[model samples]
Target: MTRTARPRHYLMCRPTHFEVSYAINPWMDPSKPVDTDLAVAQWERLHALYGELGHRVDLIDPLPGLPDMVYAANGATVVDGKVLGARFRNAERAAEGPAYLDWFRDQGFTTRDPEHVNEGEGDLLLTAGHVLAGRGFRSVTAGHAEAQEFFGRPVVGLELVDPRFYHLDTALSVLDADRDEIMYYPAAFSPGSRAVLARLFPDALLVDEADAEVFGLNAVSDGLHVILPEAATGLAARLRERGFQPIGMDLSELLKGGGSVKCCTLEIRAAA
Candidate 1:
């Protein structure tokens, strides 16, 4: 397999106000002390790595109260230069939707405020022929249809069965959108969804339990180079075997809030 690298434009937010003050999902625990400084350090490394890989990055200012704002991928879903702003399910992250929307508007990107409760790219992953939408936790089922109508692409609704993998990005990764290549943890999705995936991508990489536990599936791929968690050694090896350059990173501090590389980074895609 020959994988080609593509220049990517991404939006990111600094972990300036990052802290696990409230538990929204299975990964977060307010009782556990969060090192805000360490989270910032880890995030900076990821940001710098993107630059080193020749990717264009844009930053959004983090608000004081919105600690989860650091997870910029949850801010909105952008496809073909059109932006569909997120509507967070949890009240703790409710304000994030508007903040991200405002940024897009200010930047002169065509934006839409979604009607359904959509947690942005956290529950939305893009592929060649479909927008893989995940529900059963963050994004509502109707959000799938809304995305399809907005983006003018087929939307395959996949149900997330595991609480730990609350977001679709947490359980699956699109390694090369051009090649329609992906890898996922079957346990993170419902049985029916697993079958759906099998039919869609017969050669999808199936990751083990250990890799999934380390938030390994929460990865970012720029066609060739895949940025993932350092703890996901198993998944990294698989990616390398499949002709991808897997660059491992440490965002352990952000994991306390239920996110990793894919969560902290939002892709800004233009019409191909």
Candidate 2:
């Protein structure tokens, strides 16, 4: 089957305040130097790339103290215009939850404040058949029930075992939601979750440890085009072999905070 590109609407936050002042994840280190200007420059290129690809990009104002707010994908999960807001597990990012939800509410989207802790799109990913919810790290399993009820879609709970791939978005990328196609790292998930994924997507693209380390699975796709980190050369080739145009980007600066293409870009799947 031939791949096709569809223009998508995205929500992004400029890396104006991007930094890794604290270590919440293994990738982050307080002692490591972060060049704020470089992060913003790289992020600007990403924002421009979306426009060049004919995708609409809308930006959320970055809050001064919220450095991680640049990873807007962690803000909220929007499906069919209904918004399920985030509730961060760590206090470092706790305020980000409400800030992102307020943006959705301000935009006139239907909003629901979550009952349990789930890091928005970080733990919840939408596929054609179901919503893949992540657990065992950042988001709680109970939050899966909340997402299932709100989206009116079957929520398949997957357990993340790796600290580096703490969030679901870090370990998996839904390549084509219409086809329920995905690309993921098997090791980041538990054995049962791996089995679940295999059963659900037998033809899904699997990534190696090298690609997973560079946050290759952290990607954004528009059916035909898969935008991922440039470092994942192997994954890019695999995406091409599977009939998708892979656009490689250098988001190495953002990697210090454990985010990449998908983390910085939040898909706004509005109701048709």
Candidate 3:
């Protein structure tokens, strides 16, 4: 069966208020200051690239105190116009949860305030007809259950074993949902989660530790075109061999905050 192509809509927040004020995650170092100007320049180029690719791009106003708000994918997970709001684990990002919820509500989505802590799409990734949720560093098992109930879809809970790969987006990426194809790092996940991945996506592309460390798995794909980090040369080559066009873009500035292409963009899906 031939899959129909749909133009993807993404929600992105400008790095206008971006900075590493505190060290909430392992990747963060408050002592090391961020180059705000360079961050904005790179982000603008990415935004322009999305527009050039014929995808719709939307923006959310960046609030002053929410530095990590630039990682828009953590805002919410929207499936079929129903939004599952994020309940951030850290007090530093807690306020961002409601801010994102309000944006979704204003955009006409039926938003569900999560009872448990989940970092939106950052932890709850959709592939095929299931929601693969990650739990360990940031999200809880309860959030996975809530996602399953809220989306009315099967939620496969995966445990992230590595501290650097705190979010699922950091270790795994769904390349082609229709084909059930994914790219991931096995060591980042628990033994049980790895088994689940093997059973479900046996033909999955596995990235090496070098590529995974560069946030290679944190990519965004429009089925045909993949937007990934330039540093992941090996993964990029594998994508090309698999018949997908891999477009490499440098997001080095955002790497300091533990984010890349996928982190800066949130997919907005239409109702089924």
RMSD each, Å: 0.7, 0.7, 1.4
Query: Which lDDT tens digits does candidate 2 get at residues 1-272?
Result: 89999999999999888888888999998898999999999999999999999999998999999999999999999999899999999999999999999999999999999999999899999988899999988999889999998899999999999999999999999998889899899999999999999999999999999999999999999999899999999999988999999999999999999999999998898996
lDDT for each residue of candidate 1 in 142-232, tens digit (9 for 90 to 100): 9988999999999999999999999999999999887788999999999999999999999999999999999999999998899999999
Question: Who is ahead in lDDT, 2 or 3?
Answer: 2
Candidate 2, clashing residue pairs?
none
Candidate 1 residue spans exceeding 4 A from truth:
none
RMSD of 2: 0.7
Residue 226, candidate 1: alpha-carbon lDDT: 93
Candidate-wise lDDT, in order: 0.94, 0.94, 0.91
Clashes of 3: 0
Give the 10-residue window scoring lowest on summed lDDT in candidate 3: 1-10
TM-score each candidate.
Answer: 0.99, 0.99, 0.97
Number of clashes in every candidate structure?
0, 0, 0
